[model samples]
Target: MSKDLLTVSLDVYLGADPVLCEIVPNSSCGDVDSEDLEKQPKRSRKASVKSEDISRSSASSRARHDPVSVLVKGGVAVDPSLEEPLRSNAHVLSELDTVWHVMLNQTNISMNSNKFYLIQLLKSDTEDKYWVFIRWGRVGYRGQTSLTSYENKLEEAKKFFCDKFLAKTCNEWSNRSSFEAHPGKYAIVATKFEVPTKKEEVCKPEPEVLQVSRLDWRVQSLIGLITNLQKMEEDVLQLEYDASKFPLGNLTREQIEEGYRCLKDIENAINTKKFDAVFRDSVNRYYTCIPHDFGFRAPPLIKTQEDFKKELLLLETLKDIEVSYKVLRSARESKDNRAHVDRFYDKMHCQLHPLERDNDEFKVSMVSMYLSLGHGLTHMFSMEIVNVYSVYKEDEYRRFKGSIGNSMLLWHGSRVSNFYNILSHGLRIAPPEVPLTGYMFGKGVYFADVATKSGNYCHPSNGKCALLMLSEVALGESQVLYDANYTADKLEQGKNSTIGMGRKDGVRVPLGPLEDCGGDGGRYSLLYNEYIVYDVTQIRSRYVVEFNFRL
Candidate 1:
């Protein structure tokens, strides 16, 4: 990309935060033609002679009030002599002992120019020197410049922040108290603040420090899981996988080991119950500097288009589900049905359709998602008859969150709807072969109705759940036994022996209100000691099932 078209981000350590007076960027740099910048409006400068000018500008119009801000000072600090060097783009690194307060265009600079090098900030909790960088090159600009230039600039910029502003030895205050955490390993930057300065009399209040009382061991496990997952990226690239597969390994054992070490370093903070501390430290080390004395910031925007729109929605939904599921399971454990659904509309809103087109991988994922979620909710909500249902539920959140994007796509495209259609068609409409799945109860109730999929539910009758299992049979074609004006004496075919071939095209039957067999409910149904409807929709067979439990 062309340098003119390039965008830069700054990582600065702001000791005071946005509460302080905004500092205008330096007016000059070591390189670049000051004459040109001086002659033209110092667009990089936040301070100006007029209020109207600020409003007129669009992108950088918003004045930033960071106690510490890094300025990009744009377009290569022009120096006539280094024209050749800058044009050729030779790598150069240097540090200046003098306070970088004044701009090369000193006549225009008003604030203390003590800060130089485009990026400067006091260390967090410690005082030390930290480095900020000026990465200039073309990105996305259709120029002859090599792509590596952009990458190189980014790498240098990253290094500058890591090495300088975040000097490991920095103290709480940058004035003098900076010190290294380890012996012999001095902080990348020298200590700046140790004792109070005379000028420091009144101080602004700081927000209450965020704290972690207990380490959620899950975090460590998750981090390790993610770290290991990288190893499988390339390996699984060929094998189809989605967010659900993020924890899978993608690399060799050695690389995985290295990744684990990195994960541990990151994990240690959480394990030690110091999440916010580590996070803030990293912020100081990485995000404090502004680029080129302007609004240059670089942070990976992990959110996608859909993510932005649905993140809050999904987050709230998840939270609600978690809470409600907890309550529902508790009520069941206590054998109470008082846990009425909260925000019923919200739950309804979550109902999503599946993809319209063929998405085999997505299809498989939907299958898993539905089954898992169904299983959890069923197993947790009801102690009995949980096994009678074929649907499963789960919130394997980590896996789901990762796959949410694609799964949502499928959901949007009617894939979700289609899935339900399949089940409906097989069990309630018609089926070639009876569908059969293992059932269990009250183990992992998550977020599904145990007795029925039909939203229509009645309060439990005593401790027993009343559910209706409707089985449909197509005349002569369906395997589910039914009594729809047909002969009742056929052991030749059908799921239940009590019923017989129906003259009608289809039929619905209530399966169970299973009376405890190590559970609250239990019941068995078969035309010939076997379920005849295999699955819904996918198979165009004649039999379907309609199961209803008054639950």
Candidate 2:
């Protein structure tokens, strides 16, 4: 095997963000020459006479930008001296030839006048021209993107960045408040690749506080289940066995332990009852950040009665699955006879089978349950279904949010188009009315109906009209406000709008009569997207499914 020896170079901008005002790099110790400063046009006699006044004014301005700079003027070494690379040749030859290797000229700004801009220069032997790259982003996002530019000479390229640096400084001064409002909008420059050791060490919003309320019985119950889950995880980790043949066929005991650990973390989040924190923590375990292009935020957590209720339902389902696992684990641990174990396995398998068809999260949970139960029994009794079920289970877990970039990938397979199908099929029975809610896993246009109390009596036999026609813009499109008068033309106008307003992490769109559906007059013709059709009669019935969809 051979490794590519590609050189790389970075000009990073780091330090308090770009603020207007000129505090040129003070290379007083060495390196810069006096001729550099002297190579400038002389000021007029009038300007020269007022140089003292100008100096005082500039001092006042510098003090406003940085108080420490005021101390620096009084002979204190407040800022660290600029350090140069050991060799100039090494610096010039270090340009990375490959594209998108992470290291690019980036900048980080901190207090005490540490803000600066960098220009990356990459040498291309084949093209015989150096490639220029600069970091660009909005006022306050860590989402600095490396943009490519052309330059015939290195000095010109450096000058380009210097100019950009000045412009950015002025822009920063004008938009400092804007930058402060957006978290993780600045480009963070680091000396070397390092992992964050603390939560606040990284650029992110502070975690919201959790409050346990007795008014919500589900929260109380979830807290108890979380405590039990923690204990179970500890027990699983303490298990001593030869994991080399663990699961007896698929995952080692270590692998199973890892899954347990992930489950425990999620359970802890549930116990917090802090909706926002739970959603962020749960998704972050699997994704670095939500794609900015999607522009949609993770649904808000715990903002309304409906929001809490939905969370309660989700937690309840998770608790039920977890409890079922405990039963199977106990049976296996007791070394029950083959017949007894088989009975337990069959019973549990039937219970989990329906869940496998639910949303991605529920499906992943079912997989985890099967893996733990199957592996424990197989390790103890040399079972045979280990390979088959273990493979299926592992595959499902991989598709979940916690499993390494799984949430960002394109899922190419059958999608759950109907929300009602998931609830009815998952629970194994349909109720008179089940209030259901879930997140939008993939982007596309969807048609749904929200059951409302207004239509319960007026037209009893009219049936359910498609109250809201929802459309998820592009993959990178952000979720927008509810547009009651949204039309397919507006969608083409490049604005992302849904039929309903967001409720925490779910959507709640009001249902009104549609003219095309032959109900009382209301606008529904504009709801049509690419195609307009009148087929597919209204699905009216007593059993209605209330929707809470999050994009």
lDDT of 2 by residue, 160-247 (tens): 4444433433324223323221222222121111223332332322433433332223222322322232222222222211111111
Model 1 lDDT at residue 458: 24
Give per-residue lDDT, candidate 1, residue 251: 13
List model 1 lDDT by residue over 1-551, tens digit each: 11232221122122111122222232232222112122212222221112211111011222322332211121112111111322222222222432211111110112111112122211111122122222121110011111112222434434433443333224222332333333211122211111222222112223343333222233222222212222222212212211111111111223223322323333344335454544333322211111112122223221232322222222222222233333333433342222212222122222212222254455333333332332222322332322222221222111222311111110001111112222222222211121111111111111111222222222223343223222222223323333232222233453222222222111112212222222212222211112222212111221111212323
**What is the Cα root-mean-square deviation between model 2 and the actual structure?**
26.0
lDDT score, candidate 1, position 317: 21
Candidate 1 Cα outliers beyond 4 Å, as residue runs: 1-551
The C-alpha lDDT values of all candidates are: 0.23, 0.24
Listed per model in order, the count of residue pairs whose N, CA or C atoms clash below 3 Å is: 145, 27
Candidate 1 contains a number of clashing pairs equal to 145
Q: Which structure among the candidates has the greatest lDDT?
A: 2
lDDT of 2: 0.24
- Candidate 1 RMSD to the correct structure: 25.6
